[model samples]
Target: MPFLTSPVLPEGTLSRRPQPDIPAAAGLLLRPWRPEDAPAVHAAFQDPVLHQWHVRSSESEEEAAGWIEGWRSEWARECDAQWAVVHADTGELRGRAALREIRLRDGVAEVAYWTVARARGQGVARHATDALVRWAFQEIGFNRLELMHATANEASCRVATKTGFAVEGTRRRALLHPDGWHDMHLHARLRGD
Candidate 1:
């Protein structure tokens, strides 16, 4: 399939809009990324497990700090919204949640997330994802949200299913992973439909 590009996403997706920090779940909070959180974010992503699971680049503390600057700029400009997950009890930074591919034409956006392995199996991701969807629909006025996972990621698929994201279909050779092209399972949720 052709790439689903939307002018609404790039033109004014984050243009001078107010995006308030919101809590994601009961045990975890989802808020904007902060400069102080850079060290912890770097440390969390340093785990080999997280890198392997998400297939993202390994970064040093300095690199993480630089990336945090990008998130800050987006938040300040209202371009792309990103959130950091923190444990309510210990205040430990657990992971990240983001709303990307935001398109106002269809009233939809794509959601993405990743968490430290230590935080897995505790429903941290599920809580963050569900809460993000709720906020996106209710507050952001988005009518739909999509999540895509690699076929090999059963845990992600499980979370998508558990959160009422329907398995829309599969796109063969859709994503270029570290190894090669891989199929992706598409999941979707609609607002008040």
Candidate 2:
């Protein structure tokens, strides 16, 4: 039996993960994570709000370092990209943004983000997400990108909408958490949308 071949992408289309720092609006910057950021990452995960939505917390700096290392491995494998969202002037780690479930054959990926407690109420998530989506579409050549969040997470919903990801639909009881099953809202944006 013959199998259909995957379409060929243009040469030099994100063959490797990009390493350049991306500057976004509102004085935010997206850059690769470093080991020194572990402390900040650990602290950010301690926020009760983050735990409520994300359902996981880093118990120690070491665990946070491991998480950052995992992102490096994913980048090397060309399967995911993670960046630390920081303030350009102060170089403070405000949050994180990532593109996961990257399917090069299908030209699709999913975006996820979280902001630290101090960064809450600011537009860090929105700016970082918008920058990442632009990079994924223009530089990585992804034709479609997706963002999903717990249906009850209004803040995340706002970020998704601000970045131009339209709500596609809902997945009933799709995510399991310590509290219970959660319905997730699916949002997406196409290459030109």
Candidate 3:
């Protein structure tokens, strides 16, 4: 079951919203994506490490520019909330992270994210995911949050564990990876679970 076909989409935001001016983390921040970020963002995708973990196609300068524009517009529309990984001390864009598929049902939402290859294993994804989870559980009032990763993505599995997402179980062939259907490891972190 590709997440794209999941009934979850029906319960989540299908539009955009006014962009929030989020700062980098208190110690490490994850701010909203910006147009000026295209250059570095374009370069970041060139990292082969990122390609192996990310499911999407590599980007060109134009694509990166367009992506930034799209996220900005989506932010204004309240459809998707996207953010950039930045160093809290210098405020430099290190990568990008997101918490998507937000569904409001019985006070719960699911979260997902990625970081530039260079930023992996540096606690970048953890900080960014933590920020979003905090917002969903605290600010957004969601009581439960979920995450799923392809079984082959060991780094993601590690990230989920490090960030407190529990190993829920494995869903055989749950996602359609580039090659074909792949099993996925389901992980979750609830408000009081």
Candidate 4:
């Protein structure tokens, strides 16, 4: 079958190239997740805040390792991109940043991130998000990116706004958390923004 329009990005646009290590402000680097980071991944999920927002926890190191492998597989298939936000000098895992739900034909993806407790006040999430926002538009050829957070997640809303994602309004009860459904705030940025 023939299509009426060309894909916004070719299918292999991401998988054909190496996932670059993105540099961010505040001495952070967004690097690809590695198998060795399983322990840290497990530890991070243990944080109450992370657990609450993600609605899932790593039950064991093996489970965390599987998660890491899953991320790698996604990258290879160009389905999603996940990065470990780490300290540039010490290489400590500070957080995670990702482009989830990528649609090459539409040139869109949803941006996501989380900062560990140790990195909360130091602007890790903002820096990582800014870096990803730039990379997605400038380098990867995405036309639009969406960032959504539970209406109750104020910090995430701030990061989205600071990074230039304008609020598009709320998605009532879009995300379900441990406590119940949450009204989600949907924010978006265009490549031209």
The best candidate by lDDT is: 4
Better of 2 and 4 by TM-score: 4
| TM-score of candidate 1 to 2 decimals | 0.86
Candidate closer to the true structure by lDDT (higher is better), 2 or 3:
2
Per-prediction tally of clashes = 2, 0, 10, 0
Q: For each candidate in the order shown, give its overall lDDT on alpha carbons.
A: 0.79, 0.88, 0.70, 0.93
Q: How far is 46's C-alpha from truth in model 3 (Å)?
A: 1.7
Arranged by lDDT with the best first, the candidates are 4, 2, 1, 3
RMSD of candidates 1 onward, in order: 4.1, 1.8, 5.4, 1.0
- Candidate 1: segments with Cα more than 4 A from true spot: 1-17, 76-79
| Best of the two (1, 3) by TM-score | 1
What does candidate 3's lDDT look like per residue over 93-180, in tens digits?
Answer: 6667665555544455556777766666787777778777776665555667788888989988887898799998999988775678
Give the Å shift of residue 101 in candidate 1: 1.3
Model 2, 1-193: lDDT tens digits are 6648753344234545356688998999999999999999999988989889987889999999999999867776667878999999989999999988877778888999999999888999999998998888887678889999999999999999989999999999999988999999999999999
lDDT tens digits, residue span 25-64, model 1: 6688888788888788888877876665566664688888
In candidate 4, stretches whose alpha carbon ends up further than 4 angstroms from where it belongs are: none
Q: Say which candidate scores most in TM-score.
A: 4
Whichever of 1 and 2 has more TM-score, that candidate is 2
TM-score of 4: 0.97
